[model samples]
Target chain A: MSPNKLLPLLVLLAVAPAWASEPAPARQKELVHLVRQDCGSCHGMTLQGGLGPSLLPADLRDKPAEGLAATIYYGRPGTPMPPWKQFMSEAEAQWIVDKLMSEFPQ
Target chain B: MKLILSLFLAALLGACATPQPLRGTGDLGLVIERATGHVTLVNTSSRQPYARIAGLGDLSHASAVYSRDGRYAFIFGRDGGLTKIDLLEGKIVKRVIQAGNAIGGSISQDGRIVVAQNYTPGGIKAFDAETLELLAEVPAEYAPGQFSKVVGLADSPGNKFVYALFDGGEIWVTDFSNPRQPTTQRYPAGKQPYDGLVTPDGRYFLAGLFGEDGVAMLDLWQPEKGARKILENYGRGEEKLPVFKMPHLRGWSVAQGKAYLPAIGRHEVLVVDVATWKEVGRIPVRGQPVFVMARPDGRQVWVNFAFPDNGKMDVIDTLAGKVVHAFEPGKGILHMEFTPRGENIWLSARDDHKVLIYDTARFTKQGEIAADSPSGIFFTARAARIGF
Candidate 1:
């Protein structure tokens, strides 16, 4: 493929990776439980922040959704944030970001 | 004179009579309702909640330490709310907001003072165990204008508070022999000491390193020697998976001369020799471990996992050095506590909102107590333990 044609595809992949797919309802419930209990271990169960940073809507309002999804999918290199790609797809991370930016489920 | 004697005897009998008979605090304990700012006082003997004390602010990751007499429980809240509640009366005696954000707390060896480790102000705050009065503040300011979150606060034998600094990568010891004029000594731990624990004898403090591949150890008997690394390069060639939850190294991790610890980013329990601080063996489990706690008698070590594996719990037989029993107790098992003599073990299943009681010897379900998003299960038995 030509460089010009590849550039737009690269942007598309960067925004939403090729391996993107919305999780099913049952999977979504598991994801919610995972975020609440597992992620809550570092971030407070209230998402008010602990050893890790807060995940409340206000704390995440300023951050970009795609970048947040990337952080969840690939993990922050230096920090304690570990990659979730082993557990969920990149699109599911974006979905989590959207939920965290709004009101997360119980 | 006979009429006066009869009246005095009746008065004495009336003063001693009450509806709800007296009970000792020995069988009492508290369960933290993580979502709600409340705690339920339960009787381990009957497996029933005697009282549910409300109005504690933000107990997301709460922990409690008992007074030497086991009368009052000092609750260290996540929002830095230090509360002293009477186990016998089942009432909040005194409460104080000490800091912005607190991780946990420890009671001094003398039990006269309680100390909290804060993440917001990044320091340790000492309080009077009785009145909840702020006694002293030790800021974890490794450098000017920079504060680091404090973790793993435990009371030592010599009226000392020992803890780890996550951002500063240092372990600190604060001697409260002179509460007003306390002296502190700092030792450089590894990259990130997530949490800490002192040995049962209160001789050594070990910090779990998150940034590196080792555990940091400091001998309280020899503070001048500084902190040293143990189990270095345990995950050298192995690619570490995502550590959904950090491994916790609290009390009762050591049993039968071996220290059982949760390995970070790996589904294994690292066993270490307390005498030499060396990696003795690794017991592979279902997932990354959150709490590797030993029963009171040190015969079996119980471990719970993080995330997907959180529902499973495995018991390690100290004699065999292997997980002899594995079972799915419930969903979201957060914390576990054993009765004073290791007769029964209580586990808090956050998702199910129930505290499941199991007979340690047979691993059979004894009873379950319904709670609101329960997490930590602490018993008055912890009062006798050096680190809780």
Candidate 2:
């Protein structure tokens, strides 16, 4: 192969390493957004449970999507948990509820 | 007309009687509650403010005990830091590190030895009262996982041994005559033994029960025998009284042959006759009544309050069994002790990080000392008596 052709190959190999180390930035952004919007004010940074129940995957893994959504919309009585019905639309609640129900303990 | 006059004279004589009812000797132990820690101290006789030294800081949640000579206060810090503070200078003269959580403790009559109980994994750590050196950590008579706190320490009379109480209701009677390898005996009571006080004569060892109302009286004088309960039915009622909470059983004062117990929930201090173990009287007090120190003369009882609220001290005329005066503290007050001369009251204002000094005679604030996390307070008199 010619020297010019070898230069192009080397450039591509160098760029590929950076690409391999890159994370799925969009997914990470979505999780952070969901936590801040849905759980941050009360349960705090990692959903380790603050004023609300611990939302760790280990704690919420067994609950169904309906129950999770209902809790988000209606809220837990006698505690600090308030109904998010006015704060979030049905679809928004469902989206975040789905995320919680899907990946928890971690 | 003569009969009427005689009746009036008799009533007047009763009112003027020297023996006050609630508690006789008003030995005030000032409690200083600080955020990082708490301390207790005795008010010195000098005009200088807050001059007494009791316990140092909130080491391991354990209480401090006065050495035999009243020269040093053996105190345990929150993280296994043991200290021997010079009562005169209020300085940590010696310190030794240990293992696990420490709570309340007791010292031997000779003041040569001190024992602090470890709350978690439950055991007793004996230390040289004067040197603050680790001597031995004796395992108390409790299960491996039992929640333990050293709550009470008392020296039985006849210069015998020192008795320390644990949360799981385990009592360790250790012979302190031998400082290094002390002999110990463990006995179970109920839930948590909050305060252990021996009679002035040292005939009986009374352990104040926190979970329940009455006391578990252990006959240390006759230990081949076991402990028994007097006033077992006390503090219980259909109305559900407020039992003394954390750092339970605040003031257990044995004077004039009576145990003055300030049961917090009931808002009343019950006087129990040690001989019969009966609830003789209930003196109504303000807030969460704790730490009833009898005046040495046995004429009045001084009561103090605890944290989260209720910061005040009340003087109860024992003969009258009524609160004569109430001192509103700017901060929460816990423990207290009278100066050696019995002229002033030193208080541990734990939350304030200051020790409050009160003129016992005038019942006025004299001065206060700034400190860090002061908790247990004590004073020494004539080197013959130790106050805790």
Candidate 3:
């Protein structure tokens, strides 16, 4: 194929996924806001962690949401992380855990 | 060599530069730079011959109980080893490691039995005070890991029964009159029964409900009826509270027919009238007060922070119903116990890795015994070993 003909195809392949995957910036702002209201009081506003482990990139930002939700539901023994199942519904923890894993400490 | 010497000198200078206050607050302020095999003591008074225990080996999380006779210090290591130290001689005379996991333990009034709570395979192992021999293993209700078993074994006011708090809100009452096969009573109460105490009257048993909201007042006198809710400190009334989210950690000071419930989340002590099951008064606290021990005189209440940095001990004059005085101990203050004479107070400084001694009368700092990595400490009036 001609070099000039290949250039257009390469550009389309490279930018298509990037543009498609990017969510509106407002959605990102809403997730950050949720974390601040839900977990910030105990974990600290910066998500640096206190009374609980840090939720930043180095700790749990990329971990599985199910595992994180399990920890929230079952709670860690001998730790302050009491099971939120009694207070929050299963779907509630999943939503917060999803937001936490994806957008926390951004 | 000279560079190393210079660095050592600089470090020493920094340690000496600060003016050592006669007394400070919390466990974090108590720093033991070196680890030792002997238990350290701080003379928090202006008296004579202040000596701290040292040289105790990597015995982190050792439960230290001072003998009632005031001559020896018994420390139970996490690995099931027990060290009997002669306080006067400042040496370990006896060391014994028996079978079982030691999660929680309390020395009896006569100091004849050391009841250690086992976690993995839930149960209580009774050991002879002097010999450290396994006397009996009292089977717990739940299986291993089912419940975070925290036992509270204290000689009843009558010295009759040794009580245990199993996981899932059950209290096991064992008649210690015969350690071989004591009459046991298993009654349901509350979740995560963390800390507990038997009232001097031996009528009602109080266990701190960590998972639930308040104190599970087990009526031993009426076991068939089970434990009644004398007070709930965690959640907002009538609503079941979730763990870690609401009022969880609570401390106890039971004496003179009153249970001083220090709810960490509420920052207050819920004084309960044992006989009537009523809320007497709310005593304010400084920070997350983890422990509330009644002074021997039964007139004052001493409270220390659970997470440190909450400077000062909450001293409550029972009659006045107000915080009379607050003394800064240090940052990592865990729990405090009084000497047999009730003149000295010993505190486990986890952050500083030292046991702090405070003068109860003067409410001033006396001296500090440097523990290499001290965790839990207690002093019993029934101790058999003493030095000097």
Candidate topping TM-score: 1
Alpha carbon RMSD to native, model 2? 17.3
Worst 10 residues of 1 chain A by lDDT: A11-20
Ranking by lDDT: 1, 2, 3
Query: lDDT per residue, candidate 1, B1-388, as tens digits?
Result: 4455336434533543333467678888989988778888888889887677778998888999999888899998888899999877777899988888889999998889899999998999888887787889899999899999999988898899999999999999999998877899999999989999999988999999999889999999998999999999899868887788888888556788999999998899999999888899999999999999989889999999887789999999999989999999999899999988999999999888789999999889999877778999899988988876
- Give the CAPRI class of candidate 3: incorrect
lDDT of 1 at B321: 88
TM-score of 3: 0.63
Query: Across residues A1-106, which tens digit of lDDT does each residue of candidate 3 receive?
Result: 9998886456445545333444457755654543542343235335544324556645774677577878777776655565656544555556556545544434
Looking at model 2, residue B199 earns an lDDT score of: 61
TM-score of chain B of each: 0.94, 0.77, 0.73
Best by lDDT: 1
True contacts kept of each: 0.64, 0.00, 0.18
| lDDT tens digits, residue span A1-106, model 1 | 9998886456446645432665788999989977876787888777778999989988997998889989999999889998889888777888788778767888
Q: On a 0 to 1 DockQ scale, where is model 3? A: 0.11
Could you give candidate 2's per-residue lDDT for residues B1-388 as a string of tens digits?
Answer: 4465346435433543343334211232333333234343343544332333333333423455555545566666544556766544444587676644454466666666666655443566777665667777666545665445554665654334544444456666776555676677777666556566666665677676655656787777687777877777565654433322232443345667776776634667788887788888888777556577877666678887533234678888777777888877656565676676556777776546566778877888889766543455655442354323
B31 Cα displacement, candidate 2 (Å)? 8.2
lDDT of 1 at B136: 90
